[model samples]
Target: MMRTSLDQGTSDVSDQQGGVRTRTRAAIDAPHLRTDRWWLAPAATAAGLLAFIVYSTWRAFANADYYAAPYVSPFYSPCLAENCDAMRAGPNWDLFGGWWGISPAIIILIFPLGFRLTCYYYRKAYYRGFWASPPACAVAEPHKKYTGETRFPLVLQNIHRYFFYAAIVVAGILTYDTVLAFRDEHYEWGHMGLGTLVFLVNIVLIWAYTISCHSCRHIVGGKLKHFSRHPVRYRMWQWVGKLNARHMLLAWASLVSVALADFYVYLVASGAFDDPRLF
Candidate 1:
């Protein structure tokens, strides 16, 4: 009776081991499509965005003449008749100023793009674009697992309100650049180059984007209980409300416009295109 009992116990152990091996093999062989389908849309979007970024950045850096030449003094002879010869010889290719020898273009490009990419709105868009194509028009489905982090770094997205302020300031600076492009370069209003038009469009795009910021909408709307009752406030809120409705579209277009503007400017400065006068 004891021998029979021991034999039965050994058989039970063997069966348990076999069950675990079968489960392991099944898991290893399972189709990844079942688990990875959610990432398809987002991954494709990200890849496209990355390609655009790489192409634009490469063009910006490769077009050396777009930037001021090395060792050129800021005090180079001011050209009177659209002659950039004297300016081209200057060492201070640094358009803005020598703040740690950093290029102003790098500074401007990094902040707005960085902030937008990290913005809560953008994060939501990216996540939905990736995991859920044709995102639910209204009702968003919740994720099965809360795999996201709960740390301060991630929580910093709350500072998007402050980033909105930075965006406005940057937009203002770009506007100033637009004005300088005409005034300093002697560009006639009607006779502007491809670069000038691109730059102007970029400014408009950025304006649309800035106006569509969540914080700007709230501030304009006067989020108080009796805000709509006030006439002036009501009108402003209505305007902001219209813009806020198209915020996502504005955001994407603005991004594209900015990159294209830079490209046009680079091409013009590099002599890839003749700077035609609009007038």
Candidate 2:
């Protein structure tokens, strides 16, 4: 009888507490164990985001050398203003013409930038990386009360779904840019080069990232009750879920691709390097 009682007692530690599990502190606290290298992720994220900001800001203001034959910097595409470049690539909206010497990218980057800034994953990332709001798991935030997304600026995050629509249009524009990259300086078909490949890969990354967005996934799948009745959305939902699973990977990949695409165009336009023709 004692042996059976001991075996039962040993097996059910959780039941001893009467189906309740509680930590009595009444406040969130870090673990007692040593935290090793907990700061590295946030530090690295800060460095990368800062570097991209500085470089992008410099390139945005540089204005010149953003266009080479058959290759325009991703940062400067849809160069909507007059005096942009000889390529005359886009619609030439020209709303801001040399006014304070702002680059077209200054005007154009807002939508796409807004999309990423309000992204759900990015919210978590920068919340930890930049804001250091609890920096990592089991860490404490600097603030006493957690305001979350209820405040003024955070309230604006609700517009991410709207931004997703605009981003799809922007992706279409980028796809056109990729098509243009396929042509040579003379606009002949059957032309391929390192720049072409770069643009191609960049657009693919952008599409993957954009398509796999949390907003995109929810729009495709959420609110559906009967999957059998909606076979198409169900299929799309399934595929997007697969991509969404790797959304973080796609986010960083697309970021790097954009920077590199712009840099490649910069090199060609500035006469720093030639785009090797693979045709």
Provide TM-scores for the models: 0.64, 0.86
> Residue by residue across 1-279, what tens digits does model 1's lDDT show?
344533221332233323223333432221222433555555666775776678656643342444322111111212122222334222223444334232233444556766686665677666566554233333223444343536666666667777788778667766755554552244233344445566687789889888877778777765757964677877887897798888878877877887666656555656676656554
Count of backbone clashes for each model? Answer: 13, 0
Q: Score candidate 2 by lDDT.
A: 0.80
What's the true lDDT of residue 183 in model 2? Answer: 80
CA deviation > 4 Å runs, candidate 1: 1-41, 56-63, 67-99, 128-150, 183-191
> What's the residue-level lDDT of 174 in candidate 2?
83
Q: State each model's CA lDDT, in order.
A: 0.55, 0.80
Worst-scoring 10-residue span by lDDT in model 1: 70-79
TM-score (C-alpha) between model 1 and the true structure = 0.64
lDDT of 2 by residue, 1-279 (tens): 344533211333332321111233322222222348988988888888788889888998888888888888878767766667767354245656655356777777887889999988788889999997868876655665678889998899999999999899888888888888888988777799999999999999999999999999889975588889999999999999999999988988998899999999889988999989999
Error of 2 at 162 (Å): 1.3
- Cα error, residue 214 of model 1, in Å, equals 1.2
**Residue pairs in clash, model 2:** none
